[model samples]
Target: MTVPTLSALATQLTSYNPDSLSVADAQQLIRDYVQATDSSETVGLNDALCRVLSEDVISPINVPAHDNSAMDGYAFRGSDLGVEAVMFKVVGTAFAGHKHEGPVNTGECVRIMTGAVMPADCDTVVPQELVTSASEASMTLAPGVVRPGDNRRLKGEDLMAGKSALRKGKTLHAADLGLLASLGIGQIPVQRRLRVAVFSTGDELRNIGEHLDEGCIYDSNRYTIRAMLTRLGCDVLDMGIVKDDRESLEAALRTACESADAIVTSGGVSVGEADFTREMMAKLGEVAFWKLAMRPGRPMAFGRIASNGKSAYLFGLPGNPVAVMVTFYFFARDALLRMMGGTKDSTPLIQAASQTAIRKKPGRTEYQRGILSMDANGNPQVRVTGSQGSGILRSMSEANCMIILHHEQGNVNAGDPVNVVLFDGLC
Candidate 1:
């Protein structure tokens, strides 16, 4: 059977839900797309931060390897201690990164520091703070403090042998590397990154170094899209800006498909006399354009364009700078993330109290650019950042949070409980 056009396939995909699909449905769509993607292996540990682990890592040995002192103290046999102050000779010394093979008898003690292995026959460590002194012969414990097991770490108490230390599908971070290092692991297997191509189309667009004309604006969508893609851990192929010509846009999109896993574009998908993105999608692959019930971002498109048996999905965002950003975050971000083996939990939601008065008439959900702050009670409160127009990119930059006004809602008074989106920590 002949495959349908990109637009037709989008219709098929969206036939299940169209108007006001819940965040759950959107996330499921992403998961379905991700499950359809190919997986590959990569040798990445240092550069794999924020990437998910492709395999489970078993511990080669026990964590800590041996019983050690958890503090600077004296290691002694608890059974040898009397109800009164325990007396024992300090036969040897052990510090962090150092261990003594010497045995500590019932009447003998050994000076042991944090990370130092407890000598044979020593069941407990008394920190020097609770001890009178440390000597080669014997040490005396103070009358109070320092329990019997105080400052002592038992063998395999933290990590046991043959146990799974890190599970598959776990996202690696700085702390993960430390966990690997503690297990004597230097390298790890990680999933390969999805290569992506990003571009924006419009004749009214101008690049850096070129003077802006009366009707043109500097290309801001490209930078913003690139940054967001990087955050999702995709290797971005910046295709730069293409003119309104169909051939130029088609070639750029084709190259992205051939060399990358996906192609992301902002602008040119909307209805206009000069918009070639819709025409290109018609000729190249199956595409879907949805007029989302959202402010700033409404015309969102997604589909796959094939080239030489390899196909990369495409995401067409709005041309308005702020709209492009908001749409990308809410819609395209998770799809791209899923392509890279990630699962977005749900649609963007945040907890914040309304600080100022908010007036609205909503048949569609509105994301009002907002700034969130802590009230005197330390409760998070948010206020809208002036204008909610999609073309106002500065408003997005001015605000750090997004007040997600639900559909079928009216004006809100101050101190009302409202849902918000905390992006880039501006809230």
Candidate 2:
């Protein structure tokens, strides 16, 4: 069968199979279109945290290395249960980092601290809290204990030698740092961080600390965009704000194209007298300005910004603060991550029942800002925050989730189920 070209796919999408695509459908489309392109290289362990792993990490030895005490206590053979801590001579001392290299003789035990290797004759650990220390060599035990392997991390239990530990594409976390350090991994293969350029347009917008003229608001979208880019592990270039004039806009565009892997802009995407993005974009490269069937952020422009032997992307989002956030989360955010070679693009999603009634005009998809609180059962109960206007920056601050309302859907009463996209986990 002949594979459809990107041109053919574009033609097909022009008449989108309006099967009334859900948020998941849009997400999958983006996943399929973009392949991770970031190159990989080995970096020191200190620099590898939070970086995407480019290869599987195999363990050279079992975690814990040997059976070890998980508590600071007595390590004894479980069969010797009833004896009053049983007068077993503490044949050796086992500190956490330093372990005695010999086995405990039968009927004898060791005073073991947490993480100390368990003696070969020992199969259990009795907590130090439960025992009364009679001498430096031994302790008196308390009864009421029942089984073997208590308070102990078994040899090869947490991890096995030569086994795959963290796989390729896993993003390292703080906990993973411990695991990597335990394995003595001095360096790791990780993908490069993304390089993104951010800017804004509009003569009505003023830079921060600048005296505001009548009808001018500080150009906050650029800062917000750059900050969010940094959160997503991008190396952000603050391209600053430009006026709606074609020359300045063109220069800014060229600068972004020349230096960065992606450029994000706010304003000039909407259809209006001052919107110059459409014309400037057409002159640069193949750009798709979509009239998305969505509210607050319906006008989105996406395309490639190309130069000699290099290419980057352009994302033109709506200038309104809420619209900028919603559009970024729904579009540019995930795509940029994928393009940067990160494994996951989409944020985690779950369903929640709305706590209040919402009225919606049919046709446009809406993302109503909401606060999500947990119910007794731990399920998220969502309540809409005030004023669903796209221009309301206050609402965005008050909201923790973007409670999604479907296209052509209206009059959602309280207790109705809605999709709440949580805001905190994107990065």
Candidate 3:
């Protein structure tokens, strides 16, 4: 598939310029410009977890191979069942991994274990526990214990031969492994892991072990970004803290474009006088600097840059700690997933009642740190963490979800429903 250029995609946006861009427009820009990577390789089932599939997987054979017993019971003909208790002669015993080959005639049944192939003439089964009486050669079942074809697993019930079991661009999980194993798939083709180059750019930023000068602060954006990228299954290249100078910034961007598929940097996309990151990006490639219609992360840069014939997508985030994470999660995350060959969009937003009235405006979208908990009546309720400042990193760490106030949404009263995106889910 051809990847759309920024110029081509921007034309489709309702507001392409930074001055008038909306949250939905920015997301759609990425959805249009990015394409999946073309490289893929086959890997064993043990190593394929979380890897995206490169092609659809079709079942080679029917699952289960034949009709089998789904319970430890007596297999008998459903036509023989009556309104009263009925007894049948036990012709033979069928254990798992073994089958009863003898034909069952009228008023006869076979003792079958779970997973054992059903007899040729049997159409239903009565669980052993439901039998009223039993002997060495005969068993009696009470009336209305089971119906026709009950407790019998049909052939190809789980998956049929020649049918599609999984589609391309799917991220494999544990349950997917079980499904593939049932179809006797030992190895499968998956897309290669994406590589991302990350760094922080600021004159006042220092490494963790460095001594604090009069006005410098420890660089936390790079560490936070590196960790988040790792969790998303990317091989990260930490470019360290780049000095806030034209020469140093240019060198970092050039090297990153050559080495990685995507480039992410914090602290140089804003409008401050010292923000030279934006200038360097414009010099190297075609980039769009935008003032997003959103809180916490209003300033952002998105485009593609080329160095020495190698090109990479760029995401220039804000300087504030919380703003950096917010922009990365809401915007850059989807772009990276697209480059990695994943077809899924963002996680579904859930609705929960607000515990307290929230102060909000109508023009810009807002993402507030939210604590989701059960209320007195057991319904989920969300409350914002104290101090919604852009620099507060603790708010993100302490909260379990992000309360999303839409671009056109106004004030939220107490007991009003709010949309939220959870951070963790079942594996």
Candidate 4:
């Protein structure tokens, strides 16, 4: 597939202005340009968890394979049921995995165990408990107790033969594995995991275990980015911390471009005297620097970067800790998923009642870390975590959800409805 240049993508969006882009516009531009990787590999059912399916899973046989009893009961023809009490002569007993040899005749029934195949000529099953009385050789069922086809499992009811059990581009889950197992599939084709290179840029950012000098902080963005990528099932290449210098940043970008499908760097995108990430990205690839219409994560750089004829998508997020996470979740997450060969899997937004009044502006979108909980009436209510600063990573740790103040939305009064995205559902 031909990849469109950033300029071409910009032309397609009438409102596309890199310097002042809306969150929605940035998202759409990325979505339009990114495509799923075509490479796939066959993996065992146990190893396919969270992997995207490359092809539809077709069921080779019916789920049940045969008509069977749904419960331990007596199977007989539905026509034998009458307005008054009726007795059935128990001709034989059928156990699961064992079928009755003879056919059931009129006024005759077979004692069937759960999952036992229903005898021919039988259309209904009266559960053992529903039988009014039972003797050594017969069972009596009360009138109006069961209708035709009660407690009987039909063949191919759960899944039909040659039907598609799962569609392509679906992320496999535990339940999906069980579904494949039910279809007797031991191995299936799934898209290869995406390789993502992650790093942080700043001269003052120190790695963990290194003594922090005055005014220098340990790099946290790389660890957070790794955690998020791990949850997404990506093979993460942790490139560590890149110093705030043109040569170092350029080398890192080139290495990442040649080795990984995408590269994520947090820092140097914002205008700063020591920032060199933006310059390195522009030098290596066709990247766009943007001042997004959003809080905390306003300055970002996104586009395809190439090195040594090998290309990779680049996302230069803000330097602040919270801002890195915010931009990643809202923008880079979906794009990475697309490159991973998964379908458009946006985290669902739900409306929640605000617990307190919130100050806001109208032109930019804001994502406030919030604690979402149930009220006395069980309705979802949310309140912002203390200190909504871009550098406050603790707020994100305490938050169960992010309260979304959308663009063009004004101040939120107490008890007003607001949009919320839960963190648990993000992965």
Candidate 5:
């Protein structure tokens, strides 16, 4: 498949203005241009958690392999069961991993354990607890106690041989590993982990363990971005903080592009007197700087950048602490997942009632940090975490979800429904 350039993708949009772009348009442009990596590798089951599968896993053998008892009970021929109480003489015992080899004649049954293969002629099993007048030699079952094939697991019931056990593009979880193990599969083909280079740029920002000047603050965006990347199973290359100089910033971008698949930077995208990210990005490659119609994350940049003939996708996030997290979760998260060959999108949005009336203006989207909880009736309700300022990092820590006010949405009433994206798994 051919990958479209950013300009080509923008032309397809209804409106293309870098100065003022909508959130939805920006997301669509990124989705259309970015492509998944074609490279894949074989990994052991122990190391394949959360990795996207490159191919379908076919079942080598039938699940359960053969007809077996699903419960510890008596296995008998269903033809011997009648309308009245029926008694059967116990002929033999069948344990798990050991099939009953004796022949079951009419009026005779075999004592079977859970997972034990049933006798060749038996088609039903009566749970031991449900049997009446039970003894070592015989047991009695009331009429209608169990129908034919009751408590019996059919062969290939869970998964049949030569069938697709797990489809391609699936993100393997714990249960998927167990399913593969049950089929005796030890290794699987999975997409290679995405390599992402992360850094922060600002003259006033100081790294941890450094002496803070009178007006300088410690850098936190790099740590947060690294954590989010780790959760998505990316191989993060922490490039530390770059000084707010043209040469320093250019060197960092070039180094990142050469060694990483994607580059993420904060603080230099906004239009400020000292900000050179926009200019440097334009010089390095095809980048689009936009003033988004969104709250807390208005200034953003996205495009592909090349250094020394090696290229990488660049995501220039805002400087504000909260804005960095919001834009990443909403935009960069999905793009990175796609580049890694993952079929899943970002965390899904669910509807929740606003606990209080939220003041919102039309024509701009807002991502407010909120505390999502269950009401007395067991429905989700959300409220803002005090201030919704972009620079306030505490709000994000206190929030369990983000209350998303759409681009055209107006003021929200106290009990009005609103869209909310959870932070539990994504953040």
Candidate 6:
């Protein structure tokens, strides 16, 4: 895949300049430039949860080797039914994992259990509950009780032989394990987990459990980034806090580039005289510093950097508590997912009514933290958490969804519909 230069990417954009790129444009640029890591390993199905597949899985045989009964009932030929009640002699019983020795003749039925192979001459199964009367020798069925092929599981009904069961780049879920087990698959080829090194750079930052000075604050970004990386199945290297200086920053970047597939640093990306992180990043590799058209995370740096011929994707996020999360979610999250060889492109967004009025500008995109719940009328509604400041981590903590206000959208009135992305979803 060809990675276009920043200038070439700018030429393709007609709406904005590279310096002031929109959120959508930046996301697209990152997606185009970042490629999947080509590394794979075989893992047993029991241990492959949350792992992305490396190759398409084709079934070697039909899921169900034979036509079977879907319920415990009497299996009979459909041609034997009549207007009045029909009586049939029960020739024999068929249990699961056991088949009848011979086929049943007309007016004769075989007692069958769920998953029992259907007799050669039987075309339908009437569930035991639906059979009004039954005895050791015979059973009785009404005229409208069953139709042809009803309650019968056909051969290969779940999966056919020589057909693709799961595709490459798919993240295996619980149900996927069940399906693979049904196909008699034991081990699967999957992509290796991505290695991501994360750290915070600031002289005023201290680690948790450390004594804090008058101007120092605990470094939360590293812990936050590590937690998020762990959730994404990445092997995280937490480098702790690197003081804001030329040598320390350069050393950290070099070490990360040499060891990790991706590097994430929070703080010192904005335009400040003390912010030497950006300068050191440019010295190491070709990185683009942009003033994004988005709130809470306006200044960010993104590009590929290398040290000792080893390269890694770099994401320089902002310093604020909430801004780090917002930028990471909107920009770095999907990029890292792609680099992990995942096929899932993006998270789905839902539309919900705003419970209260919201003030906004139209030039930049805003990701407001919101609590989604049912309204008085039992409809989906969302309301913004108080104080939508970039530094307020409480807003994000309280939010179950992020109410997305687009770049071209304006102030919203109460009861207005807005787009939202949920944090929790059904497994």
RMSD, model 4, all Cα superposed? 1.6
Provide the global lDDT of candidate 3 against the true structure: 0.90
Q: Provide the TM-score for each candidate, comma-separated.
A: 0.86, 0.87, 0.95, 0.96, 0.95, 0.95
lDDT of 1 by residue, 1-427 (tens): 3544533433446433544443334444544544424585765467768887777889999887888888887888777666677677778898787778766677888888889988888878887777776566767886555656767888888888899988876767788888888888877877788888988898888889899999888899999988888876778898888888878988888888899888889898877878888788768876654566667676767777888787888888889988888778777776766665554435557778888788877666677888988989888889888977888888988888888887677788998889987786221
Give RMSD to native, each candidate: 3.7, 3.4, 1.9, 1.6, 1.7, 1.9
**Candidate 5 residues 118-171, lDDT tens each?**
898999999999998788999999998899889999999999999999988888
lDDT of each: 0.76, 0.78, 0.90, 0.91, 0.93, 0.89
| Model 1 poorest ten-residue lDDT run | 1-10
Q: Is candidate 1 or candidate 5 better by lDDT?
A: 5
List where candidate 4 sits over 4 angstroms from the true fold: none
Quick one: best lDDT, which candidate?
Answer: 5
lDDT of 2 at 330: 86
Report backbone clashes per prediction.
Answer: 10, 0, 0, 0, 0, 0
Per-residue accuracy of model 2 over 203-267 as CA lDDT, tens digit each: 99888899999999998788778878877777888877788988998888888888888889999
Worst 10 residues of 6 by lDDT: 10-19
Tell me how candidate 6 scores on lDDT. Answer: 0.89
- Compared with the true structure, what per-residue lDDT tens digits does model 3 show for residues 132-245? 999879999888999989999999998899999999988888999999999999899999888899999999999998999999999989988998887777889999999999
Candidate 1 structure, TM-score to reference? 0.86
List candidate 1 segments past 4 Å from native: 1-24, 80-84, 132-139, 142-144, 343-350, 360-363, 407-410, 424-427
Ranking 1 against 3 by lDDT, winner: 3
Per-residue lDDT tens digits for candidate 6, residues 62-156, read 97989999999999998888788999999999999999889799999999999999998998999998887999999998889888789999899
> How well does candidate 3 score on lDDT at residue 138?
99
Candidate 3's TM-score: 0.95
User: Which stretches of candidate 5 lie above 4 Å from their native place?
Assistant: none
